[model samples]
Target: MIKATHRPKHSSIPLLALLLCGLGILALGTGAVRMSPAEVVQALLGPHDETQARILYELRLPRILVGALCGALFAASGAILQGVVRNPLASPDIVGVAAGAGLAAVVNLMLLPNTPAWLLPVGASAGALAAFGLVYVLARQSGEVLPIRLALIGVAVEASLDGLRRLILVRADDSIAQALIFLSGTVYGADWERLFRVLPFAAVLIPITLLLHRRLDVLSFGDETAKSLGMRLEPARLVALALAAGLAAVAVMGVGILGFVGLIAPHAARLLVGPRFGLLLPASMLLGALLVVAADALGRGLIPPIEIPAGLLTTLVGAPYFLYLMRKTGRVR
Candidate 1:
């Protein structure tokens, strides 16, 4: 009985890891031109044939890696924020981080067309941090970050930032299509260059987030409890919020507004593995990665040559689930 009880607690990590590997393989193997699993492995491991090498290395591999990284970033960010605010609905996109990043990226594209592409991510991170800080300042009352207030203020801020994003996009005569496609959240043209662009930011943010699980757990137990246990509430919260904002910003800068992964991955991870942030963090990352890979694969396969964006697919799937979550939480009002 004791062993059985402990088994479920630890099983989720390995299971999620396995799921992520399978999804990664699936994402690589199935596209406009399908490769068998053997071909996928051979391409990954061995002497590179030109055709297989081009398909795997040039196109599919980078997209798959970027999808996985973006998913991990968003999921980890959401998990951190949800734990910090003690709200199931809190996510980067819902809370204005994505919108802020989007606004900054749009502005960057509009104003400095000649700027190195790398600076876009930096601008996005700055915007996301600024937006989150603004929301926190507006939402906090009596030194407490209340759930409803935060969510409402986040939505309001998101709406306002979204307007600015549109304003920038509208002024762009030459780059409008590019901006719209990006806003719709397509990893359509992802290549090694884009992969390298996002890798550094996500590479740094994700490991740091996983390391913060203990602090997140302490914060999740309410400010009074955290203080009683000698955890500094404000500083801890700041670090958690900053980590989340940066993670989400990097994801947005990479993938162009993945709306659902951040919100759904954490909830799904908690359901699968329980709310222990240590397990929860990694599990959420894997789950989010799997979600995006699967969505990308399905989107590519669903309509043949005309591919749907993974972001749009996720939104379609996530909206109803979001409603269900709200209903369950009894806070839809």
Candidate 2:
């Protein structure tokens, strides 16, 4: 009798989720004023010493939560975009949403340095929506948006807007620190205030995206096929784009322009879960949260006094993967 081999298929989602939880715990416990697991739990459970409570609740926990939320939102946006466009490389940053939000936020930082904190996200959202609208218009022909054309036009717009952002930064004064946050991508100052600012948008948009997961799977097929199947391809595509871009915009408002989470998370999730949006969507969210939190933790731990921005770390990690992906797909053109 031949020995039978029974190999279980590897499941990454659970591991990724567990990793996110671990990273969150470490993020709360491993800062300058370290706390034990019991103390951390006590701080979380409340009715604890004032100092430890402040450290855990005010300083550390909010940042971790914000990073996790931003990562999940960015990943969901990317998944929605890739499915709608049927292009694996489609992401909010790649498609000009981040550049637009960054540019607008920077402009606000420059012009209205004293503007109420609440207005920053509104400006960023407006900019993102405008940029997305422009890409859609540029990519549309007769009445339909083409995938390749959308990608090409979005890339072009992203480059142009990025250049504009650089030019504005060079000329602007007294906004370098804030601009650096946008350019380098860090959640250094994430707090409950910023988290609350972003929560309403994510709370609403994320559920909507999850609900539309099936529609995304349908949209992955060509437009004619989708239409033949009684799907409203154009409207559905626009709604998905709006939701994805909105999520990215709100996250940028909270955490600055953390690029590549949207791009990388979806690809990783799809590879793990095989393109079924039902599984892929949640998997991307978990992977994304894990990536950002882990990157943020590494950024904090790599040097005691000095810290690297999470955005820079992600770019370092994501750019090479992106290049490899492009080469593999022969999609560099």
Candidate 3:
């Protein structure tokens, strides 16, 4: 028993890292042209064929990097939200968070075609913050946060928001092609500029998340227990929720709403490494990155000169897992 338990704990982090590295290499090498791994490595190291070099530098590298970053952020945000809400179903995608971002993004794209590119992310961030505050307010009762009530409220809000989004999409005069793709979430057109835009936020937020890991662990242990342990319940919850919303918003802006990675990765990591927040967070981030990179690579390679959306693949993969988790919990109600 001890060996079995110890083995996973020891192997989880390294295994996740190795998987991420392998996926990164595969994503770089396997596309329409199909460069060998050696060529991919050479291109990354320096210059190879100028044409291939441009493809790698300008196109594939950024998509892979942004996919990895967005995956990590989403997964980390899910883990944090799950811990705080004490509900496995409490992912940003499941709740109203992604819908909030999507609503703003879609509205902006439809109404303000000429809006500065940079402002898209800003709008997304604002929408996310607003949604987070709305959920928290609805979830609070007499200075106490109730997990089940919060989750139910979130589900209702999400359904309503999703309905609104669909209605907007249906009535709009513009072509729905771009709106559909963005709703499905793909990293296809990501470039170095987009990567650079989100990097600073990811760099800043990930470290803060790491630092707050301990506090999150405490928060997971019920409100009364956390209070007994000297945690400022409301303030800590607000801060964590805000950070998570910002992370989720930035990711959606960067790569559209790639769902499932956030919900699936953290749960898988928890199963592998146990529920210790410290190990869980980093392991989930790496595994999440790996999943998106692999999915993106598969999307490109699955069809010749045609690709599926990475978000669609993630949803296909995630839905079964979500169902299984619900069953494990013995009904979502």
Candidate 4:
């Protein structure tokens, strides 16, 4: 069980938020063309230089917003999945959401390149929902989706989807760059439209996830305890999973396969703020925002004009943490 920390638990919220704010400033000021703090501040207020203003307003600001929004959404989704499954290892990636989105996104990019740009998100969202529905159904036994069953079935489904993705990649010779962009995950070309694409889901779903903190808290006590406490386990689980999938889907739609933020951010928050869902959710969001924005900054500045995909950096970092978590949770068991 996750107990409250020795230090003040709530302090993490502000600390994370402050850190995120600082990173946002850093992201705004440092890129291909460096700007001083004062210059960035001035640009925000309105700048006479068209070049500076365009770089700040048209290039930097939108990517930062989309990165932050997608990061927060991914964290909220991860937190919800972890709570609902009563598994510290659970995340949107673990439960087939990212796999679904990735597969659908690849198909859209490769097969339907001529379709409207907006259809990518729509197709990806539908694919995510379909994968979840399959997992939910296949995992059900006598109307109950056991956590173990759900996890196992989800992994199988995800592996199968991944196989399909690889098959598609090998057989195709066209739209490889476009396909790779969604698969690799990036905020590189993010602009006002991308920001707008991801904003609504973050605004709506994050609040709903917050409102369900009591349920998440209750669910964390395990299945029998939730049932004994008069909670409808199946209904609540479905709802939480739906929200989690939706949050993850939009993120995949907006950027690409950013699988690790959902996994990493929640545990980081829980370690600092404890497992209380109310605090954990918001803290995860802030940390996730900070994480992606920082990753984007790192990618941009790491190689100068050459940028790394945000997903690659996150997976590089989150993969080790995931192994550590598996071992830690195993030892506890």
Candidate 5:
């Protein structure tokens, strides 16, 4: 009986590792022109035929890398926010963070036509900060912020900004098609340069999160308990929120709003690994990366010659799962 109990625990790590490797192989192999797993492995290791080399290096690698980064960032951000609020439903997308970044990018494209590509992410970060600031101010009461109120305020703000974005698109002189595609969240145009732009922020933020993992775990308890445990409640909350927001903003700026990834991935990881943030965060990142990569592969391969947006595929899969979770949690307000 003891051995049976230990067997599952002992096997989980290897199982997870195997799953990740399989997903990575599948991601590399299942793109537009299907490549065998052996071909994919060969392409990565050394020079292949010119066509295979170009496809592997120029096309698939960037998309896979960016997809992984975006997924991991979103999942980490979601894990942080959910921990902060102690609510399973609290994700960056649901809290106006992605909308804020999206609105900023849209405005920059429409109003500041001459702005450099690099500055677009800067604008996105600024907009995300502004939205969070607004939510913080509006949700504060007697020097304490309520999580539920913050979420509600975020929903309202996101709705308002989304309306404004549509209005801007309607009146703009240029084609709204590109903007629409972007808003749906895709890595179709991701290249090395854009990947490089997002990598630094992810590098910085993810490590900081790992360092603060213990504090996050503590904060998951009720506020009073966390304070009694020597956590400075407001300051810690603010710092976590900042990290989560920055991660979300950078992700949105890099590849429009990918919904449900942040929420679903973290929650799923929590179920698999338990509630300790130290384990949960990294697990969430890995699972999140896997999900997005797999979804991207599905989007590219589902129809011959035609592609669906990764965001749409995620929404179709994620929304129903989210609803099921909400029902299970009985936390609907």
Candidate 6:
């Protein structure tokens, strides 16, 4: 645990929020028919130019919101899981949460092709919880979930789920292209529908996540210490797992398995804000939002005609960081 003395005061919180807003503005201005910040604000407030207003209101704003919210939710989910598992390495992607959601989504789309659009997020959330539940049950020994056990079990389960997902995708043939959107994690052609779909989940889960920070703090204190503090170990872990899975699933519903936002954002926030969950939760959210929005901006701006998937760019950065983390922690401290 990070000592209180090492925890910086709350000064960094506002700074990260400011940076996220600035990045959001810059991201809004990116892409063809680029507008300056002044123009972006003007378009947002009231459209002097019809085309500009349409683009801002219909296209860019919702895309940015989805991307930023997904990033924040993923970060929060990862933070919760890390505390639950008591390992820096635990995240939605790494711990079978994303894979579980992906598999459920694939099954929903491929098998039940005409599945109601409204059921997609629900299916994803259920899948995420089921996968983590499998991991939890398998990883526990003598009613305790050790960090090493959970990480190892998670890796095994993630691999199995991803492998199954790939096989189904290959068989789907015509659906392969469409599946890539969720599998590869792109926000391209994002619209108001997705933003609206995601908003209620965000409104509910994000606050619940913040409220659970103290619970997370307790979970991180190890089984014995946490028990001494009146925390009921098993039930608490189950609730936290469900919350984390829901956050990650809802996030990927729009963005499709964004790599490492879950892992990297919380870790970076931990460096700045210390291991305290209360401060760590919000800081991770802001940094995660900034990361996705910035990555989306760069991806869009890097090439005019072709849009790189935000997941690809994040993976490019996150994969190396993941390696460094593994090396530094030797399967996490």
Name the best candidate (by TM-score).
4
lDDT of each: 0.82, 0.81, 0.81, 0.83, 0.80, 0.83
> What's model 4's lDDT at 145?
88
Q: Tens-digit lDDT track for model 2 on 49-163?
A: 8998887778788888999999999999998888877877788865678778867877878888786767876787678877888888888888777778888899999889879
> Global CA lDDT of candidate 6, please?
0.83
In model 1, which regions exceed 4 Å deviation? 1-8, 46-49, 114-118, 140-144, 168-174, 331-333
Per-residue lDDT of candidate 1, residues 48-85 (tens digit): 67898898888888898888898889999999888887
True lDDT of residue 119, candidate 3: 72
**Compared with the true structure, what per-residue lDDT tens digits does model 6 show for residues 187-247?**
7877889888888989999898888888888888888888999998888877887788788
Provide the TM-score for each candidate, comma-separated.
0.90, 0.89, 0.92, 0.94, 0.91, 0.93
Count of clashes in candidate 3: 0
Indicate the residue-level lDDT of 209 in model 2: 87
Off by over 4 Å in 3: 1-11, 176-180, 331-333
Model 5 alpha-carbon drift over 4 Å, by segment: 1-17, 114-122, 331-333
Q: What local lDDT does model 5 show for residue 322?
A: 90
lDDT of 4 by residue, 70-154 (tens): 8888888898888888788888876788778768877877877776767776688778877888888898899898888899999
Candidate 1 matches the true fold with a TM-score of: 0.90
Q: Lowest summed lDDT over 10 consecutive residues: which window, candidate 6?
A: 175-184
Q: What is the lDDT of residue 80 in candidate 5?
A: 91
Per-model RMSD to reference: 3.1, 4.4, 2.7, 1.9, 3.5, 2.2
Clashing pairs in 4: none
- Better model by TM-score, 1 or 5? 5
In candidate 5 the C-alpha lDDT for residue 48 amounts to 82
Candidate with better lDDT, 2 vs 3:
3
Instruction: Give the CA lDDT, 0 to 100, for residue 69 in model 5.
Output: 90
